[model samples]
Target: LPTSSSSEDFHESSSSESSDGTSGTPTLEPVPSPVPEPLCWEM
Candidate 1:
């Protein structure tokens, strides 16, 4: 029972971490693109 509980906790943490990483990538990509777009527009 204890092992199963621990496994569940581990799985939850792993899933959350994976989700965070996936989200972080998209946010970072948009940030750089916006920065370049304004510069390109001004130029």
Candidate 2:
């Protein structure tokens, strides 16, 4: 579900970028990575 939400957000940003066609090499920030919890050592 979180991944879907992030993808939806990305789509929205691209649509906005379309409006400014001549921005000349628009730079985008890196997407935030999800941090995984540490696995149990004694599992």
Candidate 3:
């Protein structure tokens, strides 16, 4: 299903972004976004 594919894509994107964020950016960008995740129901 496309929704599954999109979820996979989103996960990959998150992994990539997290890796980049580890380089120097605020780790908070990833680690503390629990509140925003459910709020964004878009694909």
- Which candidate do you rate higher for TM-score, 2 or 3? 3
lDDT (tens digit, per residue) of candidate 1 on 1-43: 9999999998677556656557755755678788999999999
Q: How would you encode candidate 2's per-residue C-alpha lDDT over 1-43 as one tens digit per residue? A: 9999999998868756754774423333222222222233334
Q: Local distance difference test, per candidate?
A: 0.75, 0.54, 0.67
Better of 1 and 2 by lDDT: 1
Q: Mind sharing the TM-score for model 1?
A: 0.33
Report how far off residue 6 is in candidate 3 (Å): 0.4
Q: Global CA lDDT of candidate 3, please?
A: 0.67
Worst 10 residues of 1 by lDDT: 12-21
Best by lDDT: 1
Q: In model 1, what are the clashing residue pairs, if there are any? A: none
- TM-score of candidate 3 against the unseen true structure: 0.36
Q: For candidate 2, what is the TM-score?
A: 0.33
